[model samples]
Target: MSFKNDALAYHSEGRPGKIEVTLSKPCHTQQDLSYAYTPGVAEPCREIAKDPAAAAAYTAKSNLVAVITDGTAVLGLGNIGPLASKPVMEGKGVLFKRFADVDVFDLELATTDADAFIRTVEALEPTFGGINLEDIAAPDCFYIENELKKRLNIPVFHDDQHGTAVISGAALLNACEIQGKSVSDIQVVFSGAGSAAVSCARHYIRLGVTPENILMCDSKGLIYKGRADISGTYKEEFAQSTQARSLADALQGADLFAGLSTGGIVSGDMVRTMNERPIIFAMANPDPEITYEEACAAAPDCIMATGRSDYPNQVNNVLGFPFIFRGALDVGASAINEEMKVAATMALADLAKTGDVPEMVLNAYGCSSMKFGRDYIIPKPLDPRVLVEESYYVARAAVDSGVATRTIDDWDAYRRSLEDLAEGIQ
Candidate 1:
């Protein structure tokens, strides 16, 4: 059956979409309404006026995240428009609640203009604890995030960018560890220089990737340092060393191929050009830049991954987002900086080592556990540790960095608390 038909049938059968919003606080009587609404609300407002930070203690703002998307880049079906992106947005909202006990209001932006997007989010910022920009396409995503951060004091994070970076970086760290390579010593080739690619490059560099070793490619070709192969405000930022006419050239002796591009962008023939045991993350949704089977056959020792569920290492952003924002907001983070992401990556990489997640998590990735080997260098999307142990690392990183407004002294206790939150909220 078709996905649309199945979704409609399922939703029709079971209310098909999201249900009614439940109150966090009780509102059983008239007195409750008076307190929740008219008279009781004023006291908290007055206190917030006296000390702005008090808002976190008294209101849901600290735990609330605005899941904003424009439907411009909604999954594999790109540019489906805002209304159509509702189900996906709502699903994201459910995840926030489930994984991190975060209260999210999924917002399908009415307009697509960069300036309008910025203004709209800025206007809404006062209501949310943090803003999670989801699936908005390139250059515009860049503009919106930069503008919103400038205007709002709350942490503004674009999940597609940072989330992808964090998970991918973690996977890369482990892959390199197993392969006996280092990011600084290798040449990294990235396919698709959109929001995901650029941010990944930026963050990877922040984690010790040298500028000379990174190469970017779009549909047109490689983003060489002086080469005018690709253009656009987005591509210009990380423009580097050599002009890559194709993925084959990009893979020529390249140590890594990080795909944020399209499915089938890289082929079996291209995989042969990489260094031995080349690490390839063909992370295009639904499929990938290169299929794992093909990459494996081409380079027998290759460690492969994708954005799909039926893969060895699925680099899903859900593994990063919930806890990432949890940690950032816990400390009243001013911004979602690169260091926090690196810390997140490190934690995720460690989780891959434990080999002790739910059975379903292993089943989803075609295996139960990958014990420090070629196939198990990354974590699965639903590996549980994402909202479990990882949040503690992120929260601790925030506290250490002094970005956390509300600090939790014990990481082990905090990690358990997150697991509890996930149990109730998710």
Candidate 2:
């Protein structure tokens, strides 16, 4: 499992990145060409022009999700520029196709200006069924989602924020249950105040965890009353009572340690300092704030999680994005509401608890039985129920909330629609 430059050499040597945006249908023969281009395509275009809603059926608008990024927060690299972020976005598009059956095209806006980002995304609204704003930095990310949701008629989801929230929330629900703690009775502390941190903290809050008990921390320390350093809408929206100057200061007797910051940010001491059977989610991608082994070594009673694939409980957005998007688009929904995310999280948690585990869930990190315990409280990213359960919950929530345009008379058929989407992804 050791990574080398050779893994990337072919990718660099080939045509730019991983994907090739070729035609989906054929036009090799003249008769086929007659229907596929020029005169034949004009009728649908004309119909679409006459009736804008008809574009959904006549063109690819209904199946497409736009992956827009400002190159401000490109994976772990961070602000690597539009050119550099292309690989990651292309990879994301590939994931959307391979995992969720959503056709995604990457859009890297040249400017980092918030208004420009807003205007740009708003302008492209007509082309896609949904807009997935990825890897844009916070405060700006907050603005972009808010504006796009307001302006666009389709779903505008900031995946780094909401997808991370839904998946992490699902894991934490199971983690809290394993630790014999409920959402109403826990003191949660998130390490690193990024998109993931805010989303996790907010999900906990929406799930009935008290805002006062949930302490969120950034680089300099906990984001609290006296912290004048961090001044943004995200921080201000979910300010905590714990005014500690360090991670250790915030972790004393804390029930949960959610890390969404850089690698090695949360030390072993931080995990050990928390309450008995503490739940830890060091969810920084590529590497986490702390490794799974390091956390377990420090506190045997702790339930640990990291944003990694080669380990147990890989809390990747892969578990959430596809199904979440599928549910939203299937219903022709306008926005990804928090209630839908909460329902998806709850569904995921419940799904992980049922039946025996799959080998795909086991992954490279061994241990034959993947039970709901310290090491394996959450389901793996590849767990099939992610789409099956979460999207069901989402579709139902969409209908109940009066946001969904598509209606399903039978619950089983709704479930089938979600599964069908997953089938296409594979």
Candidate maximizing lDDT: 1
Please give, for residues 1-426, the per-residue lDDT of candidate 1 as tens digits. Answer: 899888778767765676346788989999999999998999999999999889898888888899999999988888998999988888888777667777888888888898988888888976888899988877788888988888888888999899999999988888988888887898899988888998899888887788778888887777766655445466777676565666688789999999987888787888998998799999988879888889999999988988877666778888888888887777777667666788899888888887567676657656645566776776665666667667777777777777667767676776677777656653
Off by over 4 Å in 2: 13-16, 231-233, 241-243, 359-367, 420-426
Per-residue CA lDDT of model 2 for 246-344, tens digit only, reads 788888898988888888877787777889888888887778888888989998877877788767677888888887887887777877887788888
TM-score of each: 0.92, 0.93
Once all C-alphas are superposed, what RMSD does model 2 give against the true structure? 2.3
Look at candidate 1 and tell me the lDDT of residue 313. 78
Q: After superposition, how far is residue 259 of candidate 2 from its true place, in Å?
A: 0.7
Report per-prediction Cα RMSD to one decimal: 2.3, 2.3
